[model samples]
Target chain A: EPEVTQTPSHQVTQMGQEVILRCVPISNHLYFYWYRQILGQKVEFLVSFYNNEISEKSEIFDDQFSVERPDGSNFTLKIRSTKLEDSAMYFCASSDQYNQPQHFGDGTRLSIL
Target chain B: EDKVVQSPLSLVVHEGDTVTLNCSYEVTNFRSLLWYKQEKKAPTFLFMLTSSGIEKKSGRLSSILDKKELFSILNITATQTGDSAVYLCAVYISSGSARQLTFGSGTQLTVLP
Candidate 1:
């Protein structure tokens, strides 16, 4: 059972600093996504990526957020400047096709100070 | 705007008891509904349904989708302490723009001995 994997299970950064969350989706997956969950809130979609470009993004994924597939196996989400409200559990997920079910990673807990 | 809602924010049950979790969604271009189990770490995939009136089952857990009503249900029978976790229901919106998933707040299930 191959699964998505993320690095830095927990990240702590100062406000106004830049942060990058990394994920390695399933090797064969084509569609990748990023989602976040504030403590006690529902999971919210951030962005979706396919064919080496961003397919869609939410309002939360504003000017501060950017995603890139820097390599064949790594998908990275970079936040230009962090804020207290940005603290949440960031999850990476991938699916084989457009309408298929996605497999998720363990998530990286981002904490802004 | 797409939305997913799960009833009963939290539940408590004893071993051997049966429980049913409900999920409702309102989304454009609904493609599939999925269920996931989350403990302390990542969420594990459980089931996915694309058609209405068809049931998908795995072990003691089973799920059915009702496209007409725009809702789904997950049932777990003969529960054990191991079943204690947060159950999440998500809906896939399949459009050319990007594939996004809307997730509910999730139901927290606690099974006691």
Candidate 2:
């Protein structure tokens, strides 16, 4: 079974530094999404992308956060300035169509120092 | 705000025992519900439920949605140690041209050998 893959399983960065999390969604999947899970909190949606543009984003996806599909296979989430609160497991997910089940990647654990 | 709530945050059972996890939600323009199993890194897809009454099953795990009552249940029978994991429930809601998932806190299941 084809699956979504994320790079840098664990990332550690300084508080004021920039960080970029990368994901390669299933080859044929169209819709892509980004979510985060704080250590003991529920997984929270960050943004959704389709047709090469951001379809929707949560309040947590503020000025510091941005997503880009730089190429056909890579989806990247960039945080301009990291903070302690930004430390979490960032997950990438994709679905083939609308209302379909979105498959998740193993996740990138971001740790801010 | 759209919310998904799961009951029994934690559970422990011996092998061969049966267990059921509950999820309830309150949201507008409900699209679908999904169940996932999280062991350590990622959440693996389990099932997706859209209509009520009809059950989606795989092996010893089964799930059903109750659209009218706004709840869903996942059942695992004759469980094994491998079945131990955090079960997450999420609801999809239509948001303009996009949709996002709202996840529950998840139920942690521990199956003892």
Candidate 3:
């Protein structure tokens, strides 16, 4: 079965540096989403992208976060300035339709120090 | 505020035992309920139910949604050690042309030999 895939399975970055987490959604998917989970915490929604624009975002998705669909299959989340609290497992998910089940990537573990 | 609550945060069982995980949600617009299995990385989709009282099943796992009560349950029978993982329940909210998902803290299931 086709699945969402993310690059840089794990990343370590300085506290003030910028980080980009990349994802290649399923080829035919139309909606993409980003979610994060702090260690031992519930997964939280960050943002959703469709038609090259952000469709929805959570309060946690503040000024530092941005999402881009630079290409047909690539969906990326960029954090302008990382904070220690930003360290978490970032996941990418995609769905073919609005209300369908989303398929998720293995996730990129972001570690800030 | 939208919320998903899962009961009995952690469970331990032996192989061949059966287990049930519960999830309840309070949201503005309910679209669907989903179940996922997480083991060390991203969550893998297991089931999605849109209508109430209709059960969806795959292998030894089955789920049913109760729209009237705003709850759902996931059952696993004859479990194996490989079944040890965090089971997450998420609800999709639809409003106008937009949709978002809220996830629960998840139930951690440990199946021992």
Task: List model 3 lDDT by residue over B1-113, tens digit each.
Answer: 99999988999999999999999999988889999999988799999999999999999999999999999999999999999999999999876665777999999999999
Clashes of each: 0, 0, 0
Residue range B1-113, candidate 2, lDDT tens digits: 78899999999999999999999999988999999999998899999898999999999999999998999999999999999999999999988879888999999999999
Rank candidates by DockQ, best first.
Answer: 2, 3, 1
Model 3: pairs clashing at backbone N, Cα or C within 3 Å: none
What does DockQ give for each predicted structure?
A: 0.81, 0.89, 0.82
lDDT tens digits by residue: candidate 1, B1-113: 78899988899999999999999999989888999999998889999999999999999999999999999999999999999999999998866757888899999999999
| Residue A41 alpha-carbon offset, candidate 2, angstroms | 0.6
TM-score of B-chain for each predicted structure, in order: 0.97, 0.98, 0.97
Best by lDDT: 2
Determine which window of 10 residues in candidate 2 chain A has minimal summed lDDT. A95-104
The fnat of each candidate, in order, is 0.84, 0.89, 0.80
How close to the true structure is residue A100 of candidate 3, measured as C-alpha lDDT? Answer: 89
lDDT of 3 by residue, A1-113 (tens): 89899999999999999999999999999999999999989999998888899888999999999999887779999999999999999999999988889899999999999
- Candidate 2: interface RMSD equals 0.8
Write down the TM-score of every candidate. 0.98, 0.99, 0.98
